[model samples]
Target: MSEAVISLSNAFIYQKENLILSDVNFSINKGEFVYLIGKTGSGKSSLLKTLYADLWLEKGHGKVAGFELENIKYKEIPFLRRKIGIIFQDFQLLPDRNVLQNLRFFMEAMGWDDKMKIDDRIMEVLELVGLPDVLKKHPHQLSGGEQQRIAIARALLNHPEILLADEPTGNLDPEKSIEILKLFFKINEVSDTAVLMATHELGLIERFPRRTLYCDGGIINDLTGNS
Candidate 1:
C-alpha cells in the first residue's frame, strides 16, 4: 500500500465562523504530485491552510506528515510544519535579508542549530532550484522567478515529505511560471517529495497534466489521472 502523506476523511473546512467546504475526503500518497484547481473564493486556500494547521480543522479526521490535525496542539504545530514544506503565492522572502540569511533564519526557527549543516542544506536546495549563486541577493535584488526559486529552496530546507504550495506561480509571467513548474517537477522526481500545488492556471494544467484535485461549490473533487 502507498503511504499517505496527507489524508482527510469527512473533513469540514472553515474560515473563522464561515463554513467553506464540507465532507472533504482525500489522501495524497507519498512521492505523488497533485495540482489543486479552483476558481477564486472556492475554498482552495482554506483547505490548504487547514492542512498546514494555519486554520484549525474543526470537524473530521485529518492527518499530515504523521500529525493528527483534529487533535494537534499549539505546541506541536511547529514540529508538524517541519515535516511539511509550505510555499506561498507571493514570494514572501524578507526584503532586508539576503537569500542565505533568509533560509538560515527559517532553519533556525525549525530548530536547526548546526551552522555548517544549515549552510550545506541551503546550498543543496538552491542547487535543486537552479539558483545556487543567489545567496547574497536580497528579495529586491532578484527577479520574480529568482525570488520564487528562493522560496522553493527555503521550503525544501527540512527535507519535507510533502510540499503544500498555494499558488506558487501566481505572480510570475507565463514563461517564468512554466520554468517554476518544471523545477517543481524536477524536485518531485529527484527528492520524491509529494507536492500539493494550488493553482488556477488551466493552461498550465493542460500543458503538464497530472492527478488533480478540484475545489468548487464548497467541495473537493478528485480529477485523478496518470502523471
Candidate 2:
C-alpha cells in the first residue's frame, strides 16, 4: 500500500450554526481511487471543500498532501492548492478563453514565468486528457465530455498529488460519464495520482469497485470489503 496522502481525525465542519460534518474521519492513500458517496445535503461537498481548504475546518485535525489544513495560514492556500487538484461538477472554464489560454491563466497565476515551458506543459496535459487538438477550441464549442476533459487536463497541469473531483460526471451522459471515469482511471494507473471523487452515481461506483466512503448521518463509513 502507498502512503497516506490525506488524513482526517475527528474532523468537524460547520456552516454558520449548522454542523454539516461531525466526527468524520478517513485516510486516503497515495494513488488510491476512492469514491465519496452520499445523497445531496449530506456533507459530501462540504467534506471536499474542507479538504481543498475552500472552507475552513471548525474542529479536529486534517492534512492534505502533507499540508496541515486546520488553521492553515491564508497565504499558504495557493501553495496547498498547487499540490491538490480540484474538479467541480460545473466546468469552471473561462467563457472568453480558449482551452490553451484558460490553462495558461492558471500556470501564470501559479507564478510560472517561462512561456515555452508553460506552453509545453499545457500541450502535454491536454494530450493526457485526450484533447490535444482542442487547445484552440473554446469551451462553448466543445461537447460536455470534451469540456470536462479540459477541466481534468487543467487540474493535471500542476501535477497535483491528489485530485478531488466533486461530481465530475454529473452533467455528462452515461457514455460520456464512462469515458471520463476511464480517463480518471488512466490517470491513476499512469501517474499514480490519488483520486477522491464525490458522486451520487451508484452504477459507476459498483462498476469501478474502488474503496467506498459513504457519508450518512454526519459520519463517514468505509464500506469496502477490506475494512
Candidate 3:
C-alpha cells in the first residue's frame, strides 16, 4: 500500500454554490500525527470533509486510504469510511443507548455479523481508550473526558488506518482537554494510526507540536513544507 495515507493535489473545495477553498494540496503519511489549525469558518473542516468523501472533490485530484476521490461513486463512500475513523466536536452518541449498544449499532451497520467477534472488538477498543469497564454507562453518566474517551473508542472500533478528529476537545475544560490530548497521543503511539486532528486550541498545540496545516484565505497551507 502507498505510504501516503491521504493525498490531495490541485484540489478545489466547494460548499454548494460558493467555492470554499481552492488550490489545496497536502499528503499525510502512514503513522503520522498532524494538527490542523485555523479560525472558525476557515477551510479546515472543508478540507477534512473532502478527504473523508463527506463532500465531493468537485475539481482536481484526491485519494484517501487507497480510494480515488475523482471517480468515487456514492455506493463506495461507506467502504472508504471503513478505512478511516471520524470524530466530531460533539460527542454525537446515541443519547438513549448505553455504551455497549452504541458501539454495537455501529458494528452492525459496518456489516459485522458474528456476535462473538463484535463483543470482543468492543472490549478491545474500550480498553484502548481506557474505558473497558463502562459498557453499561450512558453518555450522560460519564464526565466530559470519559464521554470523549468513549467517542474515541467508538472511532477505533474499525481499527482504521487514519483517524480524522474535528475539534475533539472543543467541549472540554483545560484539564480535560489535556487528558484527551494525552489519550490521542497514546493512541498514535500504541497503534501507529495516522491522525489528522482539526483543532483551535493553541495551548495544546504549543505543548505538543507536530506538523501542522493552516487554513486561511480559502487555502490550506502546510506549515511543515514550502508554502
Top candidate, metric TM-score: 1
Q: How far does residue 62 in candidate 1 sit from its true spot (Å)?
A: 0.4
List candidate 1 stretches off by more than 4 Å: 225-227
For all predicted structures, in order, the TM-scores are 0.98, 0.97, 0.97
Flag clash pairs in model 2: none
Candidate 2 per-residue lDDT, tens place, 69-165, comes to 8979999999999999899999899999998899999999878889999999998998888889987889999999999999999899899999999
lDDT of 3 by residue, 131-206 (tens): 8999998999999889899899989988899999999999999999999889888999999899999999999999
Model 2: residue 149 alpha-carbon error in angstroms: 0.1
Clashing pairs in 3: none
Error of 1 at 139 (Å): 1.1
Error of 1 at 207 (Å): 0.5
**Model 2: residue 125 alpha-carbon error in angstroms:** 0.7
Better of 1 and 3 by lDDT: 1
Q: List candidate 2 segments past 4 Å from native.
A: 225-227
lDDT of 3: 0.91
lDDT of 1 by residue, 1-227 (tens): 88999999999999999999989999999999999999999999999999989999999999999999999999999999999899998988988999999999999999999999999999999989998898898899899999999999999999999999999999999999999999999999999999999999999999999999999999899987432
* RMSD each, Å: 1.4, 1.1, 1.4
Residue 221 in model 3: shift from native, Å?
A: 1.3
